[model samples]
Target: MQNASHRIRVYQASDCPELTRLDVSKLGRAYHKIPKIISTKFDSIEARLGIFFLKKYRLNALLSNLTFDIDYHCKNAQIFSTPYGSIGFDINRKFLLSILHTYYGLSKEGNTVSLDLTQSVTKTEDRLKIKLGQELLQLTMVKEVLNETLELKNDYTSIIHQWPYSVRFWLEGYDEYCFSILLDAHHVDLLLATSRVDSESDEPKAKNLSSEQIEHMFNNMPLTLTGRLVSINLTVAQLLNIGPGDIIPVSLNEPLPVFIENEQIFSSVVAEERGRLYLSEFNDKTPEMKYE
Candidate 1:
């Protein structure tokens, strides 16, 4: 009797591009400043509306002391679109309610105000969600820092595909209301690009160094040089049959391939110096090179 063959599928944390540890570290550093930037922006708003005017008009509902944190996972995160890609996040419903209650002068001291999770959001609450989302996106410089052409997503959906990175943001005193944001690798790239540009601008202007000095500086920098001796292609059966100390015959092609950081640059021939082996006779083509 013949047996049926089946392939097994692998599951991963997300469908998006995988972030390396270095990428995660850079993103954490970049996002750490968000809360302070937002806080300053909020303070400016209050300053614009003088203390006397705010006291007299009773218009002091401005958001403050908000914090941004990193979240590795997310649930029920709302999806929004940007020029580069989509962003997913969900604010804590209770926190939203608290903000609304505070603005409307409602008592949130006890069970007097509690939201029913099963109940659908009212029109007022929906509007507030949209408004606040837009405001926060702007304050976080999602547009101003990345791209001015970027627009806040008006309509949002909780059903979204998993993204690689997430951030939890909330009002400092309202820890229960913390919201988590989900973003993919593209957004992180844009952020890092902006960050790089800013850092370059802030760096002291370069001094006038001669060509020789510049050459010397670069020559001192360490770089890895790689050489490929040969490559072998094998079928699964051939690979499975291999055993320890198995000698696989490989022919050396003239002017073997050379690489810089794993990228093929040129090819060179193997030569012997006084006491050491070296590469010489550089060329663009080799005898084993196949054209298709």
Candidate 2:
């Protein structure tokens, strides 16, 4: 059942109009590392599996025939239900028998394992199926992604009639084995969103510039410098009574304050040569007072 507000987008080409479904091609374009992720995880699964499997033999699972399908279904599919959703794996009897043969340390040269597809599944095969499914979920970190804390339920019936989307690939090392991972729109959306978030978070953030670097950058900029030779305090009456041809006596013996605009930064002494007054003896070691 769908909500009343839900709308279905229709696709049109030429003169014909068609109903649009899940666009898996868009997903393919968005994420191309799905195959690599599966292959890498599958290849290294044996290492993280267990001491018995590690000390005995490595499965060395290799991925091939990677594909994405919409509206996929499989008969005799073993499903494991989690809190978030359900995942399923489908393997034929022949493939299961091959895996069983490999599990028991049987040599492929001398060992003759029966490959009857019609044979009923045994208890041992069921256990192996559960173990392999659980291992796949763990190695791929699907459980962690879904935040599934409870153990997967096998006996429980899944609400999903047919998987909306599925990832089908072949695991080839010992023998060619077809593997199907059933997923729905929710799972696809979640995984894609998570990937995007991780990629965004992994990007390098802006770093703070050092004091020396900041100072070096600011030093390169052009600034206005003003020189103050002397300061004379005048009364309001003297300023108003000043007339033409009036001379104000001033001294140039002390060091004059140098300014960048109104802000004084250093001091310099007055020097006169050839009837021209100039500033000399720069000193910026100590802070200077503001020129009023």
Candidate 3:
């Protein structure tokens, strides 16, 4: 029997960039390219009538025009175990009604679209999932229409095969809706890893100080001192006669003045312990005598 060879693959977090927070402003700019208004006069008339009805019902005017954008803040966003990335959009109910009225020509005054006047419109998780599915379907339909019209399958299949990685929808002239394209496990892993790398790169690094900088920082630091004091009155003739072996008598009980940079700082008693000189009994008092 022959031994079989096997190959192993390794994955690292550093291989990917940090998952960046979605920029709503940039998404809004991209969404402006989409044609939202087919007929300006029809859209303007419908929008004006909608605005009048909204004010009559005391509804918020979030969407001023037929192609107006909605403001959305993303929260509780997570990459699911499945292929889809789940995100919650914080939006008002008036905004939802506005969308229905503008796009689908749904009446705002009907019992079918009844909304609580006191409570604001909020999308639940289930509702969001449903909305996401609908949006995905719409996107697919749009892509199909584009392909058919442009004859992309036969002519530009090589150039435009892959769906965009992400799509953003404008809400009240702002980027609000972000849809992440379904990705395979391998691609998802790479995206997350890249996000991590990007995040790590944004952090500030600790810089090392140079030798000169270190020296400059420590130059003004105070130093410890161990000092002694002695006084002797001697004539010029006596000082001239003094030799290396000459013994000058001085008081042993007197405290020595300790100095820090030529300034008398404190006084301490000099003592001997086991043939080693030691400073003891330190006090704030300075010596009465002064050096010339």
Worst 10 residues of 2 by lDDT: 45-54
Cα RMSD of all models vs. native, in order, equals 16.7, 27.4, 30.5
- Those runs of model 3 whose alpha carbons end farther than 4 Å from true positions after fitting are 1-222, 243-246, 286-292
- Provide the overall lDDT of each model, using Cα atoms, as 2-decimal numbers: 0.61, 0.63, 0.43
lDDT of 1 by residue, 185-225 (tens): 67766766666676678988667988997999798775666
Error of 3 at 81 (Å): 67
> What lDDT is reached at residue 43 by model 3?
45
Winner by lDDT: 2
Q: What range of 10 consecutive residues in model 3 has the weakest lDDT sum?
A: 148-157
Q: Per-residue lDDT for 122 in model 3? A: 48
Query: Candidate 3 at 169: error in angstroms?
Result: 71
- Please give the ranking of all candidate structures by lDDT, highest first, separated by commas: 2, 1, 3
lDDT of 3 by residue, 1-292 (tens): 9999999988698987444343332332332322232122334433543464355434333332223222333332222222232212223334444444444445544636554547543455335444534343223312221211111111111222222233232224434422323322233334344444555679875498789878986995547684856766789999899899888887554778777768778888888877767778999974479789
Model 2 stretches astray by more than 4 angstroms: 1-60, 106-109, 141-151, 159-161, 173-175, 204-292
Quote the lDDT for 47 in model 3.
54
True-structure RMSD for candidate 3: 30.5
Question: Which scores higher on lDDT, 1 or 3?
Answer: 1
